[model samples]
Target chain A: MNGKEFWIYLAILAGSTYLIRAIPFAAVQKKISNVYVRSFLYYIPYTVLSAMTFPAALYATGNVVSAAAGLGVGMVFAVMKKGLTVVALISCVTVFVTDLILKQGI
Target chain B: MKQFLRGVRNGVPIGLGYLSVSFTFGIMAVSAGFSWWQAVLISMTTLTSAGQLAGINIMTVPGQYAEMLISQLTINIRYSFMSVSLSQLTTAEFKGIKRWLLGFFMTDEIFAVAACQREVSTKFFAGLAVMPYIGWTLGTLAGSLLGNVLPESVMNALCIAIYGMFVAIVAPDAKESRSLLAVVAVSVGLSCLFYYTPILKELSSGLAISVCAVVAALLGAFLFPVKEEASHER
Candidate 1:
């Protein structure tokens, strides 16, 4: 796109993004007095993150084996209470290596 | 001075992480025919994995405005929750303009770090925010400019950074409670369902994953409610 078109496109994109982000703050500013709504809001992040991470780790490459390997390594490290950096390294390395070996028939 | 150093120290790992993931985003944007400046600009504004991913998807599909909006909205809806949760964590003095300014810097990594702190001055948090903000923006610029230099395998490896970040976030909480274990388990299970179920496969990946997480978390919470601590006598 040219400069004018690009700017227009970006403006719309930025506006939409800012709107979504600004909504909760806007709602709070309005002084919504609902305890149940507030409680639901508190749990949204944990649920959203879980949903994002879970499925991909499970069905990567259409095979349970690879997913299992990744999850296994991740869970073990997680259970051992390793730090985020450590668990991430172990899980990814495990999946990458296992995927390589499985693909190579080694 | 000390706060600035602490910001720098905390920011280094996150900055390194951003370099890897944002590089992939940069490369993807360039490959999709976005200009270097455009890619950099997008990174500067969004500074989010899901948002960037959605942006790429929208760019790829010509004239799909509705699809693009929904895609971006779904992916970013989590931020609303992050914002709400974090609102409580801020000090009473951080009302009005300061809250809005701090809101801009509210991100998953920043929130995780801030949540762990017992009590920190808003100035320290602001200082902390500046480093990652600059690092993420610069990382994207560098990545966009350096497009296609790295091999695909290396790029694939870099995608693991977010997962690493998640592991870091969940590890502390998981260690502390069995209930959190249920949350993780249910999340994994729900993810599997979305991946394997043929009908659900038609839904967008972002939506599928997000729905699974919300459902799993609600189910887990209901099944294993957190027990209240014993009340102390007045």
Candidate 2:
């Protein structure tokens, strides 16, 4: 908690995190030949993002209705192949507006 | 150089999204009595929102280094999986020190964006990592220094920014291929099952996500193995 101890703690924390990312990345060189492994790797991105997004996104804005409004808007733009900034900014705006509508009871 | 600039451009939105999240992190850390520099240091070094948040909770007065170690490892194990996936996307010579340096910044956003590339170059990956680091550190400094300048509702709204970007990355890919659609759907279904069911709900967020990703991807691999020509197709 003090200045001195903070450095050590940060080192341990950062060191642990760095190793997790570094080791696997360094280990897996040359192309993976196995079909199952290759396919699994290919699908990892989509699956991880999907799992992280759902349900969690629903609760992100603290209000389910507003969050869903944001998520729906984001999904619409994303499916349209809009850029990341466009989709994300639109979602934020949607959440803000939805929260206003809910609070004002309009 | 062009690739590097392109990476920087692609990183801009991610950096913007990070500003909100790290700002909240800054507010929380300062409110907890830690100084602003401490929060900035954590963001700079660890570069993981959930892991750093967990670290803060575990870092009591006495400092449970053992507990912090385990908790951080648990929360960030997915990065290991992500790194392995990314390794396949890099050039043959991208190894040794470069792996350690770049892997240090391999947050979910950077990984998603980098993976979208056919192959990641060192310059490009380094450039992609730059702004998020600046945004994360600067945002924390601002939040810690300024306190709650942003409205609560506005801060809450910004919460969706990262997730929106995630959908932006994955949805179009899913649209391109039914197998990917199945993977996303199955992952989401399993994720909800873990999130909602009483017993499974107790699983930590990181573990729950890993389980969903691996199981769904495994099923995808078995049922819909890609032909050799399309193995690297995304």
- Report the number of the highest-lDDT candidate: 2
**What are the per-model DockQ values?**
0.34, 0.81
Q: Cα deviation of B5 in candidate 1 (Å)?
A: 4.8
TM-score of each: 0.78, 0.97
Weakest 10 consecutive residues, lDDT, candidate 1 chain B?
Answer: B225-234
Per-residue lDDT value at B77 in model 2:
87
Off by over 4 Å in 2: none
- Classified by CAPRI criteria, candidate 2 counts as high
Q: Identify the candidate with maximal DockQ.
A: 2
Cα miss at B177, model 2 (Å)?
Answer: 1.3
What lDDT score is found at residue B183 in candidate 2?
A: 82
Model 2 vs truth, CA RMSD: 1.3
C-alpha RMSD values across all candidates:
4.5, 1.3
